[model samples]
Target: MDAPIRKHNATDEERFWAKVDKSGDCWTWTAAKTNGYGVFRIKPRNMVAHKVSYIWAHGPVPKGYEVDHMCFNRSCVNPAHLRLLTHQENGQNRTGANTNSKSGVRGVYWAQGQWIARACIGPKTILVGRFDDLGEAERAITEWRIEHMPVSLRDRRRRVSGPLADA
Candidate 1:
């Protein structure tokens, strides 16, 4: 196996996290996004820089894998918690209200003879509103996503080519 990300002499994970300033609401880093979700910048955005720094310091990324945010936080840079996963595996692990299921992404829970919408994310669970019907549940998800995760104008998809195709 290759050396751990900490082995790199130039960039150190511990040092990277120390440079982060979270006084602002979002953890924004100066690094450009490498391999899509992987952030890399000389300065720092929020806390994501640490994660990118760790990978950059190490070596080339392995095949068929993607770095995932274990904390489910886009801004968190805690190296100890950062993990690797396949693209498909990442989708399978979706919790809360992000899953594309008819049962509801997150808020709705079936109880007794009714469907209730309880928006729970991270460590907090908000009652938001309960839905008596499935249509109500779907409506809640649509509204929630619209208000929270609005579609980005810039495309975030990454294109990766196979090895040795330049023949």
Candidate 2:
């Protein structure tokens, strides 16, 4: 679906910033939120706050690209931390392992006495490899991310810890 055309008048800009909690690097949205991301009602449509902020500062986000929050904060409307990325790239930049993950590492799971590494791109989930060691599986997933994801999307700074710390 196409994004709503924003009316960037002085009054609209004032109304937009009124809901922002500009206390830190992340200019957090204090308005209504869905799934932790801010939601703003712009007449006929309810639009995302960050998307509105991006349009206010820059322009309409390019077609086929999503606005990714580099700081990983959904409530943030800071344009400096925002970038245009494909859906796959946006998913690759996701923070933390899934809540249901038993392995503690993202894309690594234990099954049938082996650690299986997998990577998801768009709708397709590709099996990277299977290994007896969790470290090997983690490494395989990391390699896949490095190859398929952009440098900005890769979660390289987060050191793997917990049960898989050594791994």
Query: Which predicted model would earn the best lDDT?
Result: 2
Candidate 1, residue 110: lDDT = 72
Give per-residue CA lDDT, model 2, range 1-167, as digits (tens). Answer: 99645556747677788889999999999879999999988888999999999888889998889988888889999999888888767778877579999988889999999999988877899999999988778877876786777543445554343332345
TM-scores, each model vs. reference: 0.37, 0.79
What digit string (tens of lDDT, one per residue) describes model 1 on residues 40-148?
Answer: 4455443345446447555444788766665565555555545676665554345445455457445567777777666434456666566687767645644553344
Model 2, which residues run further than 4 Å from truth?
A: 1-10, 151-154, 159-167
Once superposed on the true structure, which residue ranges of model 1 sit more than 4 Å away at CA? 1-39, 42-51, 56-59, 98-103, 106-167
* Residue 19's lDDT in candidate 2: 85
Most TM-score-accurate candidate: 2
Clashes within 3 Å, all models in order: 14, 0
Q: What is the lDDT of residue 136 in candidate 2?
A: 78
Minimal lDDT window, size 10, model 2: 157-166
Q: What lDDT is reached at residue 76 by model 2? A: 99
